[model samples]
Target: MTFSIVGRCPETGQLGIAISSSSIAVGARCPWARAGVGVVATQNVTLPALGPQVLDLLEHDQLEPAAAVERALNANGWSEYRQVTTIDAQGRTAFFTGKEALGVHHALAGEQCVAAGNMLASIEVTAAMVHAFENAAGLLADRLLAAMHAATDAGGEAGPVHSAALKIVGDHTWPIADLRVDWADEDPIGQLDTLWQAYRPQMQDYLTRALNPTLAPSYGVPGDE
Candidate 1:
């Protein structure tokens, strides 16, 4: 019971992913991304290895997103029960929804974007998410958030969405901005969008301080540097 969108920011060249699910702690289980690398969302039955497997394939110069997905699925015997999407550093994207996944499961893949979900209201939910990401402006995370919002508006997970997450990676291959809003009283997607916007300025300030140390704007200088 999940809907997820994974995409690369054409503006910032940053890789990002956003996910929401009817399940508990979806943030910890669904989205996986590495800066300057790629992104993977392993849902459905959920095999944790798919996350690193995409990185391994991409590291070996597996440029085609479809090929990398094939390699990952083949390596994992439980593929029939999994739904996965992988977007490489070059913005090549791929997705697969397993046969045994819940009813109404589907996958959509496109340049720099992939959207997938199971037990959703309709294929329209996942498709809307993809369309929103493809057409939306702003950073990868923002696009992803828009996708999530669209999916929720279309009826998400065929039930309530309890947990949500956003992940953006920087040059260091570590999550420069990782935020998760797990479980909301009602309208979790709206809450997720609000959280992202509210935190966006602080995130921008943090990265600004890190990158533009010479200026040292009002947000204070980067101590990590």
Candidate 2:
């Protein structure tokens, strides 16, 4: 009941994932990324732990995306019910769609990205996502958002998606952008886009505050006045 794209910005080495699902709070369980490591999207009977486990292998163990995915599945008894995709820092990609995955499932691996979907309106959903991500020009987040929009436009989940998420990590351990519409009555993707627009200008500010509060600008809060 989910579709997602994981991509890397070659210019900045940023990793990002955008996803939407028929389930609520999909963001909390599906996407994971570590700066300078990789990104993972685990869904369809998702083992949330698998997301971090894959990243650990990619980052600490120096495993490529495919090898990390292989090791991850080798360690799990429930691999047959899962759908996962990983994109490493070097843009190496790997994906698995279990036979037990619900409904129609498909995946696409591209230059610096991977897209996957289960319980989709059609297998073409993943393809559309990949195309949009590769062709779109702009910030990494915007390209990711475009891919999510394309997925929905090309027939996303088998049912209406109630939640959406966009996550990106740059050089820092913290995410440069993390936006989610945990449950929305309307279009979760659109809501996520709005959140990104609102957050983008402050993204560098927040990072600066974290790395050097002395040089950080005002908070624009009442106390700062």
The lDDT of each candidate is: 0.82, 0.92
Each model's total of backbone clashes? 0, 0
Candidate 2 segments whose C-alpha is farther than 4 A from its true place = none
lDDT of 1 by residue, 81-190 (tens): 99999887888888888789987898888667889999988999878988898898887778888898888788777777788888888676568778887887677777
Give per-residue CA lDDT, model 2, range 1-225, as digits (tens). Answer: 899999999999999999999899999999999998999999999899889999999988998888888889879868989999989888899999888999999989987999999999999898999999999999999999999999989988888999999999999888989999999988999999999999999999889889997878897788763
Winning candidate number (lDDT):
2
TM-score for predicted model 2 compared with the true structure = 0.97
Residue clash pairs of candidate 1: none
